[model samples]
Target: MSTQPPSAPVAEPPPAGWEEARSRVYAVGLAAALPSTPRPLAEADGHTLAEPLTTRTDLPAFPTSSVDGWAVRGEQPWRVVGRVLAGSTPAPLTSDGTTVEIATGAMVPEGTTAIVRIEHSARDPEGLVTGVPRPRPEWRLPGEEARAGEELVASGTPVDPALIGLAASCGQDTLQVRRPPRAALLVFGDELLTSGPPADGRVRDSLGPSVPSWLRRYGCQVRAADVVGPVADTLPAHVAALRSALGTADLVCTTGGTMHGPVDHLHPALEALGADHVVNTVAVRPGFPMLLARVTSDDGRVRFVAGLPGNPQSAVVALVSLVAPLLAGLQGRQLPVLPQVTLAEPVPGRGDYTHLALVRLDRATGTAYPVRHVGSAMLRGLAGADGFAVIPPGTSGSVGDRVRVVPLPLLPGERTW
Candidate 1:
């Protein structure tokens, strides 16, 4: 019998459709999702759950008073027998014409017939309580909110503060979540400055400092030390940097060198590392040269590399286009859905390529207005924009036309008007 060696990596096909590229990247990441681990609720924020969050016990384990009232037995005009504050258990109403003063959230005692609000009840010098009970019961019964073992949140849901509170109420101290993917950034360019303003025909490296923040917002664990910049514009240097980053990172992001320019070495470096192209290029304006590749190590470990265009705004476009969906899939999350916004003005399309025009959303009016200085290499418009208004290929957006918006991930407590 003849045995065949593994197939060699092939060249990437023609530029893929914008949506197709995103979906393809997402699928690849999902197939290699990180393993699940147990994390304390305090540390689980911003992670995705690996399992459904179920209630360990009935929500409100016992009957609880919903109002500050008197728990009466048999009828009103009952003699006060006991009091029950929150977190305390009370004795059952053992006889007729008896009552217990109960605070909100206090467990209702057994054999209590009804609850009368304190404001609706009157007490005379005789030490008796009298009030008319409303037709509806004022106390919440056990499992009112959820039953024991009921699923409160589905798997793949991102953990937020509210989710933590809900999990705590369900008697959970730890959550089963997918560990965040570790990422490293490699900014490739010789004519880039790290500090101060651009000078001597060299521009400031904007992506090195900013891309890590964007990765963090997408739930990737990016360390300051992992962000390397201005790597010598040589093939060997590119290969060395990529190798080192892939050693400790699940994903490596490289800025610049995505195109086949004079100094571009990213494609050759990827080839030297035996990487398979997941996405070579996308049919999108301003960032069409973006690409994603999959690399495997000798020990069978898999990693990914995303090539972002060097232009500042174009790099951001690549981020939301390829990196965002890839991170979501790695964390066991579903593909992100774009929100719709009415266009406040007309915006031209890019012929066969999808146009992602920078826009600031008017939340009050649910409208998207185009921003200024939105050139492919410009950052001024990106800094002031809330998101991009997607005008699909072959069709231009008109006034009042509804379009999908790709929102920027805001840091916790950060807001954009």
Candidate 2:
């Protein structure tokens, strides 16, 4: 008979405002699915690991030569016995007075303790050399870098290129990683069209064109994006478009038609589809109207929908604050908090709002300066930005004050500043 008591259920709190609601949403959103199937090491870049990796074989499996030199026993003018090429397994290196010419990366002969460069040794027909009186241990011993069966990498680590090299050295031909989530972007606005030749007060559909690329950079497999007109009188078309997207996507991100007004029909549409609002608004400036919702399809599978501000800059900030972290979590990534940095200029008055200021880091001075343009609707400001400095709510900073800055997603080979 089982003696364990039934676990008591804790009381659940009601979702309050944005911060509390978002925290709850993230708790539920994080890596709900187990990581995806294992992939070959060749295809694992940009993927998150499903399981920890241990070394199968020692790095530099045997004592190997570190330089193009002569492998010898003790010091001194010695006779050349034989040569050991990189691939050939030489007979057990067992001579003290004799030397063997060993190429770089070749296995060090069994008995040779030190390696002397070929240039340092004089060759003669009789195979005797001088000036090489003492031999130093130049051999890179087996398992010196990493031993077999050691924990090479932890589970859920993003497969950075260096980790790939480590995996290869550990004899791993493949890795297990989370599957990239599939998503669709829908931009709703009658005044917007794709950029080209704009006519009659119409603006380009910025979110549709730009957001997908950003999503891809964060590891989302964005399948498609479309621009739908803002139909104030009837939002059925928009709702239908969203339903269609939900059919094939794990998430659907939309821009515009989110704020409170007669034309703001996204809220009602979401309610009609049985979606629950995780956050109706965020506290961050330039992204104050951002909203996130989680919905269950008719068959009970969950999906996420983020409603971003129509302005390009606001949309970008909202994505960074909400989407990036959420996606990273879902992909089994362990993202560290932004490292702190010092500001190069004073920002005194902007204290009421949580600010996300675009900034560039000075490589020479190790300082970060906020960029000039920070208007919510501005795109040019973001174009010149490398990363952002976060100013926490109710506090301002002076020129030399340090603040935390989050970096933009960098490509595999890019250097971090």
Candidate 3:
């Protein structure tokens, strides 16, 4: 059997600013939906809804007690009729002066006109209940919060834990949701390590560990087994890895090999695969060579590729610049709104390139200060910083300059500050 020859590489010049590159990427329009399926509510967290979700039943389901006291029909000093728990039904109150001892969230018996709080009510030795009922009834009427058949969530909504819980409460055992976009990682340098510390011209593979995690935050289902390759320093290896990934994933992310250095084989591989450049590169400091491409499979599936830089922090910026938006578009989500931040001090510019400086924002003030150790290859500044302070091309950011900032992924137990 004869092997096919590789295609000649295309050398395209990128526009000299970030906005131009971003516009180019946006215009190419690589957005496409992944498959939709019915997932159990137990497993629907983070998935996007493929259709509108309606409530199967009214919220509260029945007339429920809002206070742990008495469910009384008329005035104070009523004879206790029965007890009502959260799950069990209680007998009806026959007399006007009868009451039921009701727990919070318990279904109130028929003829319950008011709920008296335990603190406001008293139980006499004769088993009679007495209290002043607050002007308003403390009972939660059925459908008080939401009505049956009402729209609970719109199509394209993300199924968060709260949404899943809401669905479960509305008798939804399963949700029809869009599948998480599948992705494959190709960390291209030959010198990267899977394990130990950097030594003798080789460094630990940060992208392998970091990219997959970031992709998850961006709504991609990147399995552990698929985070393969810093492919060999050959054009063929690059081509092979990309081809294999495209077969399975809707998005393929490659770290490093973005530049035209002697060892950089990404452009050639992309050429060989007949991939069309969506955004060749952005004019941005530290990660100027970031690129996005679209590859059409023979089966008609269009897969996206995000080419990230070799440097650790640069790679992260590139991911934020392109892949995040790509994933958002694919999942039918809106582009995240960057928060406005005040710069604590001056951040110098880089000619026409937009500067994305990793900055630690004041926890109390929302003021961003450029962190130390922000070189492209360094991760120290990124680890400590809250977000990137975007300074525009050709101008240095002055103290208290207001600019948009994109936040890092929230930690496991961390909420937005």
lDDT of each: 0.93, 0.75, 0.84
lDDT per residue as tens, model 1, 1-417: 759987998766789999998899999999989889999999998788999999999988999999998999997679999899998889999999999999999999999999999999999999999999999999998999999999999999888898999999999999999988899999999999999999999999999999999999888899988999799999999999999999999999999999989999999999999999999989999899999999988888889999999998999999999999998889899997899999999999999999999999989999999999999999999999999999999999999999999999887445452
Q: What is the model-wide C-alpha lDDT for candidate 3?
A: 0.84
**Local lDDT at 350 for model 3:** 80
- Runs in model 3 deviating more than 4 A are 1-11, 20-30, 88-94, 195-197, 411-414
- To one decimal, what is the Cα RMSD in angstroms of model 3 from the true structure? 4.5
Q: Give the Å error, residue 68, model 1.
A: 2.7
Model 1 worst lDDT run, 10 consecutive residues:
408-417
lDDT of 2 at 329: 65
Pairs that collide in candidate 1 are none
Off by over 4 Å in 2: 1-26, 75-77, 129-136, 223-234, 298-300, 348-352, 415-417
TM-score of 3: 0.89
Model 3 residue pairs with clashes: 187-230
Candidate order by lDDT, highest to lowest? 1, 3, 2
Candidate number achieving the greatest lDDT relative to the actual structure: 1
